[model samples]
Target: MNYEIIINSIASIGVILSVIFLAYQIKKNTQASRANYYDSLNKTNMEFLRQLVENRELGELLEKATSNWDNLNEDDKRTSNYLFIQLFRHWENMFYQHKLSVLDKQLWTNHLNTMIGYFHHDGTQEWWLKRKMAFAKDFRDFLEKTEKPKQIYPTIKDLTIKNK
Candidate 1:
């Protein structure tokens, strides 16, 4: 009778330990899934922004040129300004979501400053405005050159290997 009681106690403890281990595994898997979801979202956002910058058509440039700050028709000005602000907001969100470093932030700030200078210039007619637009195009090229490809898989695998 004593032997049977000891065996039953040990079996119960083993079952409880297994249950605890499974729960911990499930929790870890859940956290990893959440992180991957956020990372996918971040990558999608960056790709969308890059595509927009790359695919700006000539018609869009003409539209921007027509809608001058000084002489914009009210509705034209409103829409242009709204779009500009939204782009700026997206840029800022990307910067934070991607965990950009101080150097990256400085580079982005310089790009913004260049645009601001064009916006504030008093003599920005079609000729100078076109130059400014070219400047923007060049900046977009620079960003494309600088952006690192997403390497989440290899990075995570290396980390796991290191731990083991």
Candidate 2:
């Protein structure tokens, strides 16, 4: 009887230790997953920014398209369309990530503010009206419901004028 009780206690302690170890591993994995996801998102954003930095013509086109889409020539308009598509697709991905709790709330809020700032431009709004359907319905609905700022965010042109 004494031997049986000693074995049962040992088994119980081993089971508890295994459960604790499993919980720790699960937590470690979750942290790693979140870190990996954030890193990927940052890399994607950097790639976009790098393109704008490395290609002066593309940067200029983006500025013009965001500020004056109607004034662009047919070819410029097509290029601008593709640019906006890529930009909005990235935003849509961020939106879904936030919805899935993969993205941090504060980070999502910052991104949302930037998105709203972009939308404050009439040209961006016009582009969205035409191309919004290309995105997922949920993302479209989220953007449609977002409140744009009353004042437009400063563009490169606006900054140039301010400097002068």
Candidate 3:
């Protein structure tokens, strides 16, 4: 009977240790998933930026769309509008994921704030005005409720000067 008791106690300890190790593993997996989510988001955003840098025509269309929509020719307008829709679709996915708590709050908010900053432009604002209703209602509601930036994000030079 004593031997049985000792055996049971050892088994109990083992079970407890297993539970603790599983808990640690669960936590680690959760963290890794979060890291991966943010990494994917970064990659998507970087690709968009890279496209703007590498394609001169795309870069010019984006500039014209943001600064003066009227300056665009018919082809430019079609291209600009297409690009804006694609960009917004990406952001809408981010918004939906963030709403579902799939995204880390701080990371999502950082990206959201930068996107909202871009929406401050007249051309983007006009596009949103025309097409806001076409998006998912929940995503549209979130965008409508969030505060947009009053001014465009500053250039790197501006940031450098301000930090000095």
What total of clashing residue pairs does each candidate reach?
A: 0, 0, 0
Query: Clashing pairs in model 1?
Result: none
Off by over 4 Å in 2: none
Candidate 3, overall lDDT?
A: 0.80
CA-lDDT, candidates in order: 0.49, 0.88, 0.80
In angstroms, how far off is 76's CA in candidate 2?
0.9
lDDT, candidate 1, residue 141? 46
Estimate the TM-score of every prediction: 0.36, 0.92, 0.79
Query: How large an RMSD does model 3 have?
Result: 3.9
Tell how far residue 36 is off in model 1, in angstroms: 1.4
lDDT of 2 by residue, 1-164 (tens): 99999999999999999999999999999889989989988998898889989999998898888887888899999999998998898899998889889899998888888888887687888787888889999988888887778776778888999999
Residues 14-122 of candidate 1: C-alpha lDDT, one tens digit per residue: 9999999999999999777656745764575566456557757422532453334446555655555544444434544444543533224554465445344433333
Query: What local lDDT score does residue 80 receive in model 1, on the 0 to 100 scale?
Result: 50
Q: What lDDT would candidate 1 get against the real structure?
A: 0.49
